[model samples]
Target: MSKPVILCVDDERIVLDSLRTQLAAAFGDAYIYEGAEDAEEALDLINDLNEEGISVILIISDWLMPGIRGDELLIQIHKNYPNVIKILLTGQADEVAIDRAQKQANLHRCLSKPWSEAHLLETIKSGLSKL
Candidate 1:
């Protein structure tokens, strides 16, 4: 079987690179890492990966991106792929949005932007532990 995937979505290429780099370093070859610049692209990627028989185990998305906001995106993803863990990484999401995602998306965690590598890894490990 293909390795499970961890997807990171952000409008900034630099942020995407940072997330992938840190994930690869911490996870080694244990999971496939994917990136999407926006919610529409993320959904398409998710569908494509699913069709390929690759499981998307986790998603870490930015809340302030253009197009679909992270909370809404996670809720939509949860409706279709309920078992996939969701994490919102943002510096700008309001409490209402965070709470909505927590309830509707079964969101695993919400980490602030300019995240620390240690905290990010810890969040991932914690989320993965429940799977």
Candidate 2:
């Protein structure tokens, strides 16, 4: 079977590239890393992966995007894949959105933009440990 996937969604390509790089560096070949430039693309990618029998293990998304915000996208994902760990990597998400994600999506953590690599890794480790 293929390794589980970790999806990162951000409108900015640079941000997505950086996140993918960081994750790949930390986790190596243990998981598949994917990126989407928007919520629609992320959703499509998730569906495609699901069809391939590759489960998505985690999602890291930015809150301020062109289309759907992180919280809404996460909430939508939660309905179908509650087991997928959710983390919001946003610099401008409001408390209401974060709280909603926490309640509705079981959000694992919310980290500010320009996030510290160490903290991001630690958060992912702790979040995965719960599984």
Candidate 3:
């Protein structure tokens, strides 16, 4: 079977770098981590990967970004890629935003900022297991 592809979106380069490093150590070559500064760029990467016959199985996106909120992006992705698991990594989780994420993105879970590494890994493992 092909390795599961995981696309992670975060505006902070530091966060992205750290996530890539950690995910690489945990998942090895079985996962692909694509960290983008914005949702638009992530969408572009998704299209490119799709063309290459790479199907992304999971997405971990921040709720707040410079362009295109995470909920909005996930909504678009859900419209097209309904099978992909959507997760939220964000500091802001208001009731309204949570509602929107649930209704539009079908968010699997929302992990807060300053997440513990063990927790992150465990959550990701659970997300992948569902596939």
Assess each prediction's global lDDT (C-alpha) against the native: 0.97, 0.96, 0.86
Ranking by TM-score: 1, 2, 3
Q: Which candidate ranks first by lDDT, i.e. highest? A: 1
TM-score of each: 0.99, 0.98, 0.93
Task: Mark the regions of model 1 whose C-alpha exceeds 4 Å error after superposition.
Answer: none
Q: Is candidate 1 or candidate 2 better by TM-score?
A: 1
Tens-digit per-residue lDDT, 46-125, candidate 3 = 88888888899998898898979988899999888888899888898676887898898888888899888899889888
Clashing residue pairs for model 2: none
The residue-level lDDT of candidate 2 at 129 comes to 90
lDDT, candidate 1, 1-131, per-residue tens: 89999999999999999999999999999999999999999999999999999999999999999989999999999999999999999999999999999999999999998899999999999999999
Model 3, which residues run further than 4 Å from truth? none
Candidate 3: worst-modelled 10 consecutive residues by lDDT = 1-10
Per-residue lDDT of 29-105 in model 2, one digit per residue for the tens? 99999999999999999999999999999999999999899999999999999999999999999999999999999
Cα RMSD for candidates in order: 0.5, 0.6, 1.4
Give candidate 3's error at residue 66 in angstroms: 0.7
Q: How many clashing pairs per prediction, in order?
A: 0, 0, 0
Error of 1 at 85 (Å): 0.9
